[model samples]
Target: MEGADWLRTRLTSLHCATCGRSYRDGQIRVRAQRDGLSFVDFVCRACGREANAIVTVVGRGRAARLEVGELAESPPGARSPSLGPADVLAMRRFLRRFNGDFRSLFGADGRAGGRLGA
Candidate 1:
């Protein structure tokens, strides 16, 4: 399968950040930008809030960055990127668990596909 197809399958199964609602697999919308970034959105079922998620695959170092909603933005008082080690760890875990999906999304030519920590 192509990268976009793989990414779409994985992203659509993610839970909505606002309401913790889990979307059906392959049902979520994914848009890829020219810069190689993927945007995923999910609306909270409880509060009707929308959460925007961004995923960027960096160079061949097998590094992937993820940001959720406005939390990724540096607010007026924030001095740096809002992500913490714990958050990074969580993202890593998620990626590791879903490495298959990512590999399909990015393709074998993109990077070595394996579990996140493997």
Candidate 2:
């Protein structure tokens, strides 16, 4: 998490996979991360099942900023940054509602189509 403070700001909520308890920053442990993605693990204080995430940044601004906080870049077109803070906020909202399914999330109108589905 040396260079992932900006990412920390965006991930405002995390849910436990074991007992469905909401997670806090102090409970999260960063396993690894790159420019636009991160692999993290957190233990559920309620039931002890570890929760993991491969956090992806597709929003805007710092999501496109270099890992070291604007220290360098690969030229303009090389990176495709989104519009603005609104985009980032939208993505955060999406992640907060993530149900851990790709088909339900992207296969049909990008939504959960049924009860107990993502």
Candidate 3:
């Protein structure tokens, strides 16, 4: 497997420090990589908390060595990109207009592929 894929597997096995929830593969995003260093973001779906980390992978193939460091943890009871009253109101309006039918909401013509806000 590629170095990033291997690193993601390792991260997926770990739980979020704030929420204690196992991270899904989709929640682990590799933002950038160069040489032996990689920047990764781990976003917890349950609590909407994000943690930034740096991973180092040296060598290649089976002999590759992996190390992780410089993890930026959020302060206790802190949430990044805090939401405002306007955001809550906007969400309330959307939810009020939203029905349970996601297929129709996202356009069953396959343009949106069932993703919200597509």
Candidate 2 Cα RMSD after full superposition onto the native fold (Å): 18.9
Residue pairs that clash (backbone atoms under 3 angstroms), model 3: none
What digit string (tens of lDDT, one per residue) describes model 1 on residues 19-96? 566765444446554466776554445544555567654543334433333413222442234798999999899777
Model 3 TM: 0.54
Best model per lDDT: 3
- Count clashing pairs, candidate 2: 0
Better of 1 and 2 by TM-score: 2
TM-score winner between 1 and 3, please give it: 3
Query: lDDT score, residue 67, model 3?
Result: 76
Per-candidate RMSD vs. true structure? 18.9, 18.9, 11.8
Report residue 2 deviation for candidate 2 (angstroms): 10
Native-referenced Cα lDDT, model 1: 0.53
Reference-based TM-score of each model = 0.37, 0.43, 0.54
Clashes of 1: 1
Instruction: Report lDDT (CA) for all predictions.
Output: 0.53, 0.57, 0.78
Model 2 spans > 4 angstroms off: 1-3, 62-118
